[model samples]
Target: MSKEVAAQFDELAALYEDMASWPFRHDIETPSVIAALGDLHGLDVLDFGCGSGLYSRLLKRSGARSVVGYDLADGMLGYARRRAEKEGLDIEFVSELQPRFAGRFDVVLSVYVLPYATSVRELGEMCGALAGLLRPGGRLVALPIHPDYQPDPDYYQAYGFRLIPDDDHDRPPRSDGARIRLELCHGRYQASVHAWYWSRATLEAALREAGMTDLVWRDPSTASDPAAAAPLLRAYLDRPHAALILARKA
Candidate 1:
């Protein structure tokens, strides 16, 4: 991750959970991630770029044999550790992906983190790291901001989110290093952070170069409970706000 991006997250570590609790995350993204993950029984799961270990704890509760959460920010990892201890959950949270963990996970989950790659090379390096972490036949499920995402006025108004593109262009196509301001408003709280963008082709090529296969794109609507995703689906069908990539290590 870029230092700028890491610093941005570090600053939001205290409020990350509260801002992430918005329906788009709890109701839409979480279910979508879990659905793409399929069964977790007895699997060694790794939550890459795990902020506050939300999905790490969820994986453990879902019967993962072992769960490890990795992040770049110290503050985020601290929060994750505290939450795990308080909940009596046996989760290992690490700041780095040590060599010992290579080829050790059955499933790897990354949520809203990949876009921080400022360049295609950085994205390829990330894919290679993810590939190395997974055992043969292991799966990687990632949720990143949709490369084709466009700010929909109505959707933003209804969902309490404000999209502020860094570029002054009316509507710019997906590009590496493109920055955008993501503003969130839930109840009385409001927060804004900048994020980098990546194009779909760039991501797909990187995954393939990293030796992944059977790539699949899953829509948010196909979450574990379609009924619960119905309302969110309508907005997504018009213009997807996120991308779910399911790939397997060969």
Candidate 2:
């Protein structure tokens, strides 16, 4: 991660946990990712870019044998460690991945992590790293900014967020690695982060180059148990800002 990107995450650490509970994340993101992950029982999982340990905790709760949460920001790592300690979960939170840990997990889950790669090579490295952590045949489930996300910046505002081109120029981002701004609008707090855009072709090429195969892209689904916002999610679900990607290290 770049110093600037790491700094942005550090700055957002204070609001990260609260942001995790917003409808966009809790009701939409979590469920879709969890579904893509399927049964985690007995799986050794790695939660890459696991800010605040949200998905790490969920992976354990869903019966993963072990979970390791990795992130670049110290503040986020500290918050994640505190949460794990307080919750008495044995998950490990680390700011770096050592060489000794390569190919150690049965499943690798990365939520909203890919967009941080601002260049094609960076994107390849990110995907390569994720692939390296997985045991042969292990699953890699990720959430990247949807390749077909709604163009209008305010289209997803009802779900507490918006994605606008950084330059306010092209709507779908005319090219790969285009910069974009993601705004989080919620009752607890408001925040924004910078991310890059990658089309399905670009993302697939990167993953395939990293020895990953069997790509499946899924749209975010609303909570199945009739969440209060269930009625308000038709549009976003149809044109969600994020997508769940399932693949395997071959």
Best-fitting candidate, scored by lDDT:
2
Q: Give the Cα RMSD of candidate 2.
A: 2.2
Error of 2 at 156 (Å): 1.6
Model 2: which ten-residue window has the lowest total lDDT?
222-231
lDDT of each: 0.80, 0.86
Q: Per-residue error at 244 for model 2, in Å?
A: 0.9
Model 1: per-residue Cα lDDT at residue 132:
95
Candidate 1 has an lDDT of 0.80
Model 1 stretches astray by more than 4 angstroms: 152-154, 168-173, 222-233
Report lDDT (Cα) of residue 88, candidate 1.
100
**Which lDDT tens digits does candidate 2 get at residues 175-199?**
6878888898867668888899999
lDDT of 1 by residue, 39-58 (tens): 99999999998888888989
Model 1 per-residue lDDT at 64:
98
User: What is the lDDT, from 0 to 100, of the residue 75 in candidate 2?
Assistant: 80
Model 2: CA > 4 A from native? 168-174, 223-229
